[model samples]
Target: MKKLITIPLLFFIVFPARAQSSSLEKRVSINISNQPLELALKMLEKEAEVHFSYNPRVLELDKNINYKAESRTLDHILNEILGPSISYKVHGTHIILQKAPKRDFYISGYVRDGESGQEIKNVSIYEPQTLASALTNTHGFYKIKLPVQQKDIDLKFSKKDYDLLIQPINNRSDQKLSVELQKTIKPKVLTAEVSAIKTPQVKLDTTPKIEERLSSNSKPQPVPVPEMEVKEKKVNIDLSEELAFIDTTYQKGKDHFLNWLMTTKQNLHFRNIQDSLYKPIQVSFLPFLGTNLRLGPVVTNDISVNIIAGYTGSVRKLEVGGVANFIRKDMTGVQAAGTLNLTGRSFAGVQAAGAANINLGTSSGIMAAGATNISVKDSKGLQAAGSLNVALSEIRGTQIAPFNYATRLNGLQIGVFNIAYDRTRNSLPIGFFSYVHKNGYRRLEFNASELNNTEISFKTGVPKFYNIFNTSFSYGRPNKPLAGVGYGLGTSWKYGERLGSNLDILSSVYFQEGEFSYLDQHYRASLGFEYKVFDRLAVFVAPTLNFYVGYDESLDFSSYKLLLSERTSRWLGENARTYTWLGYKFGLRLCNKS
Candidate 1:
């Protein structure tokens, strides 16, 4: 039984191995004369017991071929019948025929200074169109490969402070090419004759030139020169343009302790140069100790992985850090951090962090944080945070947090407390309390209704939607009074400058005999017509529909002017009674226009 099992297992494994062996090793016998290449290949395929795959256009199947083979390896027979450009690969019993690619052409040599005849390191040699590049080693040697090209290919050599060099070569074969770079001309510094004399006062005629005059101007006679006052007047000069080529120094603004631990001054000097260089990948332990080394802050990378915190010029794809990530310029990709994320300029992708996200410039994507999110300039996306969200300038998206603030809001805000300083008509703030300082609606209303002798309500928010808090009181019998305090929402509309209408819905709990022994719930809806009497004052009258549910019959009904009364059935027990009424109210309102 053991021998039989072993034989079956061995047969199964051996058969698969043999079947998967290269089909090109199979022997074939064939003989054909004056046959088309297509027919010849078909004959060989049958003899070898293998399938052939090839592009007819590339294989020139119509070409005539005279071939004869006897018991020869399939590879040998095919090689003899095929041109040098055609190649083949075999898999099991199948064969794939393809046109062979041209050999890669290599350009390898040293880059040296033209004047000094010394090797230059770190010189960038690249093909502009393909972006195939190689950097010179310490010995100034570089080797780069280029694809097959019929025309002359141009390779560019660039280095900071050196003139860019482009060389063209038409050779298809590998070649050794060495070139020298020349230092660029120094920038021309402008010279200004600054004087220390504050008042050298020599008055002369103030008139346009005689030949260039558009209109005639009165010319004044010259006055005697006055004694000079030696007071220095400082003049500021901007060399941003002239010195831009050599200005690699980065702007290290207000310093923090992280600067000492994460970056070096020498690395900052290469920021300008590194800004022009693009790299595919960067791995860093910190800002100054990374794959790009001292130039980490100047280079934009496609994929960046930071063991701790990292600082880079920008990110084109994805960036992740164990602690935090700082970007010197704009980022156009997703960035994630364990603690915080800070971007210097605009950002246009998703940014998330464990602690906070701060953008010094505008942003236009989703930013989420555990603690807070802050945008210094305009923003146009969603900001969601655990604690707070703030936009110092303007926001055109949504903010969801415990506290949200913006200079101007053009979208929605949802939080515990929302504050927007600018009056934006399109903004909707939904929270426990929302305040718009400039053009928010606020009103103090004093009104009297048939059901209550005295009523006062305070409303605040935008005129489109606002919150209301009100209180009502009534004198029933001697020493027996009724009082209610409630909250509601209201909206208002204007017909013209001074005339408007409002709608409000409110609910309140009434207290009777200075005790909470019985439940008295009141519900009402009011529609009011208002007219402005002065700048900050208005008068209004409203028609109200009121509903009241009571449990105690001993509670006085003298204070209520009810139109209908009925005994309630089951919800609040046999003592419950329901009352409904139609009432009217007149009021004086002190409000700010919104």
Candidate 2:
């Protein structure tokens, strides 16, 4: 029973190997006059049930093959037809046919400068025939793997500001070659001046002749010489030396200290030493505890966990700190801190801080801070803070804070007060006071009303809303000639490019015969249509509703009143203290439009 089992196991293993070898060696009759190499290979593949692998670039696929075989092995036919330069090796059931490999070789070493002996980095070492290339590392070490080829290979080494070197190498085995390159000297152009004096010598005849002629009796004239005036030279005064006498020793020291402080702050690396450390995960008891570098000058990690604080050169994924998180260069992922989150360069993704989020450079993602959010250069996303949001350069999105300030804005600001130093066209400021230095609107208007014949109004604010101050003087009226001052609010709505409408409400007190008494008070509301005749000039007409309150009979409404002809209605108990009338107004305005 044991012999029977062993014999069956041996037959099962040996029969498969024998069958595979027989399949490779078996061949059939193939008769073709001029067939493509691919078609001929396909015939062989069908008969032998095998696949062939070779580099298509090295094979002539379109070439015609003419062969006739009768019961010849595939291996014998391939060897006789494809020549000795091409060979085949059996790997499992497939046959790998390729150009015969010569010998494998490699070249590796360091590249340096000829004079300084300093290693050169980023030097390109290439072989043109094989298209194989390699670059030197920071230490100027390079290794190039070469395939089997001709005996000799030429390598070209090149870099900027250095002369290129081409060396011919024989590939017998692996080699270690160290090459030094020389610096190229640029030629300078030299200029020289050549003077040539080639004049022919000529003889001159010395002769003086005075011909006799009729002389007229005329007086000799005297020529007057003009006097030359001398111009005074200007002397330059040196104010720098004169101003040096002023005592600014304390100011100089203060400025020096401030500059030093800024430099130190920018150079404050979290790691104490400069070395490359890539950690997949890091955990710290405190900011300084469990850290290889005392400060951690250059720590790059995927994730970081801190008990009190976290300091790293850069964080790629996530960093959570109990108190604060400070990054020296850039933080690309989420960073959360209990107290502060500060980045020296750029901070992308989400950043949340309990106290403040400060980015010294540009930021593109969202920032939420309990106290303030400050970006020194430009911010392209949202910044939300409890107290203030300050962008020194420009903001492209929204800013929400108690107070918002930006140098230039292209977004929206929602706060108690918003201020932009430059003009902003796309930014809308929604606050109690919105101040834009270059885009504010101011106008002076002269208007005439039924109660006040002549009035001068000053309007100043943003284009959408403005404050109005008006003073009016009326003469030739039924009552006494009065002067009054009023304060109001006005807003504008655009109808077209050069036309708009305005709504205004105002209240005023009139002074009668130079008396400082509030015996008469006037309230007016008007809606007007404004058209811009010129860039700085506009005209407006409005119908107004006026209410008058007088202690005595000092209310007037008689001249050119468009409406409310009757005054018999005692709307407020028939007393002279209160009256209402309808009127119309016409005005001309001059202002700057943003």
Candidate 3:
């Protein structure tokens, strides 16, 4: 009983003492003058009642030390003696000292306009290679922290309406920098006859090192302006600019929601952010739930898989989505989706979708869709869709769909209805109805042919190729009561001011009382002379060599004489008769211009 009571007393006494010594907050007094660090620490250990533990090489115990503390906390004494090169941790009654880790460097500066010397806010300051960026505040002040790097950093500053500035920085320590930007100036307007604008001279600064200005105890000092050089850039500006489709209009309903969801940081900073960080792979359930976190749309990925839908900055290799893939910028490789694929800028490779593919910028690729494909700018490759294909600007390749539309076409279009708003001399649009708006041939004619007494026809397309639709009535034959409708293609050439020639091939189906009957096909080569009688009216007469193919021999031919006739079995089967004859036609053409 006496031994147990004594042991308990000893434990209580020792536990309190150890707890007091363990805490660096404990007050201690020490005075060591011009003593070795090894000896000084030994003296401090006794005063603080704590053991000093460290690697001798790191602590450099042989170094001389001079420190004094009067009733100060152990923490204060240790901080003064250790300096910043070494750090210490407490464990029980012991202090373990080790070398400190490398510190992060800071860069802070101001941005101003070159001429006005006024502060400019919202200017983007970034390191292109590292993608480390910061923006200037309202006061045009900015700050960024950077890790230790081996080489110099290339920093860039950019803003709209201002010239881009690039600064090389040596980030060995903290620094302060100031930059000036010149505003972009518009050239003087010239006469309408001038097709291009001359190049302008620009002032570009020389790359200079931004010196370190930060000190351990004081703030950064003022920075000096770097030197620059004046350089001339040869530029030819065309007044007749190409059209581009960028949705700047306000949106509502579903469009608004989808755009909001797919909108990314890159879209807002495309002009300033010239580089994108590469990501080898990305897997996402949705735009917000991706492996890239909130920066999903600011990185280019090699392979991207989305379960439902995904949004990204760019695609370098392949991207597939269960529903849709929305790209904020360019796509260079294959991109496929179950429902839709969309790009904010250009695309260069193949793109396939179950429903539709839409690109707001130029497309130089092959695009296939189940429903439709739309390139709002220039398209350079093939596009095939089930329903419609549309290129609002220019198309340099073929388009095959049920309907096709382009502002200018340099290739071919195969669809039921094709329309080109601009002039195309070498393009061919093969369909039931084809229309070209500029310098295209379109005319409505009323004429009497040898076979049908009353006929009305409409022609629309380019002069090189056009579509024709005509319907005729044989009114005097009451007993037969025949009506004919025809579809054909024709080519026209203007010989002079008032003379033109046309070659047409038409196949008309004649029926009585809307019942199927026989087919009448004819090829006519004629030389027409048209005299403009009014602003939108012209009278033309043409003498033609007509080769007629008639399926029904029961039709009377007493009114007209044939130069040549042959009876044989052809596409319409037995009793098919072919006749060659000379015919004459006179018509009034109603058109937009003569």
Go through the candidates in order and give the C-alpha RMSD of each one to the true structure: 17.1, 21.4, 24.4
Candidate 3 clash pair list: none
Candidate 2's residue-wise lDDT over 516-586, tens digit each? 64446788999989899998899999988887767545544545344444354443454454566787899
Local lDDT at 470 for model 3: 88
RMSD of 1: 17.1
Question: Can you tell me which runs of candidate 1 are displaced by over 4 Å?
Answer: 1-262, 270-274, 473-482, 512-519, 551-554, 558-562, 569-575
Candidate 2, which ten residues in sequence have the lowest lDDT sum?
265-274
lDDT of 1 by residue, 1-594 (tens): 999999999998787667646577788778889999999998888888888999888888888998887888888888888977898776678788999878678989999999999998878776644545677888999998887864657887878888888899778788999999999899898799877878788889887686766464658669999998999989999888766643332223312322443443423333214225567888888776777555555577888888998877778889899998887777888999999888877898999999999887789999999999999779999999999999988999999999999999888899888888975787888876777877787889999987678889998777777888899888664322378898888889989889999999998887776579875788899999999998799999999988777765665443555575555555556556677778789989998856
Better of 2 and 3 by lDDT: 3
Better of 2 and 3 by TM-score: 3
Candidate 2 vs. true structure, TM-score: 0.45
Report residue 62 deviation for candidate 1 (angstroms). Answer: 75
TM-score ranking, high to low? 1, 3, 2
- In model 2, pairs of residues that clash are 270-295, 270-296, 271-295, 271-296, 271-297
Local accuracy of candidate 3 as per-residue lDDT tens digits, 1-594: 999899999998898667756578888878799999999989988987789889988987878998878889887888888888888877778788899877667789999999999999877787644456677888989897666763778778888788889888865688899999999787888766856778998988875445533324466689999999889988988644331222334123324544576534433344444456577888889876786544556678889899998888788899999999988778989999999999877899999999999987799989999999999879999999999999989999999999999899888889999998875677888888998887668999998867677889999987778899988898747433277788888888876666666777676667655446555566666556676677578888887777766665565444466465544556555566666778778889887553
Cα lDDT over the full model 2 = 0.75
- Whole-model lDDT for model 3 versus the true structure? 0.79
TM-score quality measure for candidate 3: 0.56
Which has the better TM-score: candidate 1, or candidate 2?
1
